[model samples]
Target: MVEVADTAVRAGLSGPRHPADPARRREARAGYGLMSPALLLMVAVLALPLAALIVLSFWTQSGFTLDRTFTLANYWRLIAPSDREVEWMGLTFRLAYPVPAILIIKSLVMSLTATVAVILLAYPMAYFLAFRVHRNKAAWIILLTVPFWTSYLLRVFSWKVVLGYNGAINSGLMSLGIIDAPLEFLLYNPAAVTITLAHSWVSFIVLPIYVSLEKIDRSMLEAASDLGDSKWKRFRRITLPLSMPGTISAALLVFIPTVGDYVTPELVGGPGGTMIGSLVQQLFTKQNNAPLGAAVSLVMMLIIGAMVLIFLTLIGYWRMRARRAA
Candidate 1:
């Protein structure tokens, strides 16, 4: 009896296997295996390059060759009080202790101006497309995106011709007797750079805002109207506030790129149009100073990062407040 009981107990102790556990384990393995390729690609494409840049930014270089030694000289040089002008590739460069400061301010101003202009221009256009022009919405959206098919370089260069001294505006003004001489202010200035960048990136700002605005429920607006809200009041209290997310997102998209743009400044910005990006390019290509260039790039990255963080924080705070109020 005892021997039989022991055998039975042992058999009972060997519990039934869980089919779900093995199935779950297999599924998890398959999911990870599928994702591994994409994960590796991301690491190779983005992570590795970013890590290399960070490392290179700290390394000293001589005549395009990097030194293995680590040094703080690159960062220190940013604020080095030197009256001696650094000349590279026949262009004389002076270190203004305040150059970085000025660059940040200028970049922000230009970006803000461009963002505001895009929002103002895009809002009405987007609204018209979303609410009023529903018959051919897809066609209109395609038309809006058609500019992207053209080469960005060509489009920007075309502006040079349009805004040149002997260009379209000058000819038109002359034909109409609006001016006796060609206006020099038409191109190669900060204003020209701002205008060109705004035109180039207008679509980026418009598309996102349009999508967001289009998603807004018309019933909400109708409810506001039914609740005795005036047209202006409805827009102010409802339409504008609800559209804040799109506006904020558009501002971010425009501001981030415009702040780092070198091409616009080089092409349209004549004398006083040099930004931090131009400085970085000079360091890398002209001066053959990779460390210094890296430092500048890192600084620019930090500035943009800070701006993004602040914008996100503000958005979060506003969202929380809005939710609480609701």
Candidate 2:
């Protein structure tokens, strides 16, 4: 009799037409139904425009009107280097780089320089906040984020003032009898853009690193300490490895977006600091070449994506090696 009861209970629990599956299926259906609206909105807002851009990237334009006919001319021009005569200030100059190539190379170099600067400056601040500050942490975070509360354009313009000729630095140095004239090099150059981007994105880099460092288990550090590990060794083997996810994440966050950043480069970056984003804007708007602009945009996205992939691969290999050694 006991065996029969056990058999019945097991059948009820595990067999088809079971008691709980209907309720679970209903819950899942409801969940999917709730998410459908958000999914639809995403398709309408993002997917539709992206599809249009992709389609337009393959189309051709003639005399301010698109043909809507499939062609690879836009992409071919971007891929093949072409010579162009640039008449700047009534002087004819030969440029080896097509606009697309010029923008791509310039943006890549500028963004990389800014990324390295931001990461170098942000890491120490994040480390100190995570491990050194023992009180009022929220206040520090708020203070750090204070820059973001202001408008982005306002912040970029502020950098222009600080770096301009007769701006704060130049005037201050002049007042101190350090220099006879204002520093012309401080504004309207790649250096100015690099500095402004680093300052503008510091908070973004810091927060990810801070969150990653904060997630580290203190007991692991204590255990390493107990195992005859020096402070430096403990940090190298424990602290850095655990916090790398956040560090890499912060890098991606800054590196990817800044690749196409035109605002900071536009305001402080004179002719010397012109970036790809600005070029794309001109291509799309002033030139009325949306197809070419789309092509350039896709090219930039691909390059940035490739960079991210390479970074992730390196990080994965490092983690694998560390795990194997341990």
Candidate 3:
């Protein structure tokens, strides 16, 4: 009876005593309460519009009235290839290729080209600033962002001024007797579009890369040097690996938006340089086909998402290999 009483007393005293349970529960409740406003705002702002976009993609637009009838015609128009042609200003043009594929391909090519150009130019500049500029780094950073303070439209237009006939390059060349007349091919071309995009987004690449390189451990480089590694070798092995995060960031920042850039192409792309974005805009504004536009936009988004996934996967593989090799 004494042993049983002692066991009972011990079990009663040690019965799953959870300290601060009430306090933890209250803290969790407060955190959730604090997050509720932002969550509600996101649902109202982002989620609703996205849902509406998806719904709109299913409905057909006849004249100005959106038909409640659902159809897959819009998406079919994008993927199903056929002999499509257009006539404008009494000029008939026949396309042997699919219309949607051409527009999407042009956007991908232009975006990839511009992203490469921006990173190539930005990496060197970032390296210089991070390694060489011991003083006035703040001033340099401020100056780097100065171009962005101006409007994006203005920046694109500025490129127009530089590339247009009788503009800076042509005028200078003519003045030096290198050419008799202004070069007409400088503007309204894919190269011009690519160059303009590169200049426009270079600051993005430079700033991120500089930040990444700055965070790299100098000790690693010193140890490499101590081991008789050449400057190029040290940079190739250590610095490049470390700076990849910034490089990838810069690439994504430059690539994604450039794919859908309508304004730049509309202003300077001419007929040959028109992108998928231009087509989507035309569908919405000129063609009065909101449903088709929504479908196209969704398709573009899906393609871009896929491209991004592939790129990130490749980058991850490369990083893993580099780490293992090191």
* Candidate number of the best TM-score: 2
Return the TM-score for each candidate structure: 0.82, 0.86, 0.85
Ranking by TM-score: 2, 3, 1
Task: Give the better candidate number (1 or 3) by lDDT.
Answer: 3
Candidate 1, lDDT over the whole model? 0.80
lDDT of 2 by residue, 150-248 (tens): 988998999988989979999999999999999899999988998999899998789989998999989999999999999999999899878877787
Off by over 4 Å in 1: 1-38, 81-98, 319-326
Model 3 off-target regions past 4 Å? 1-41, 83-97, 321-326
- What residue runs in model 2 are displaced by over 4 Å at the alpha carbon? 1-27, 81-97
Worst 10 residues of 2 by lDDT: 88-97
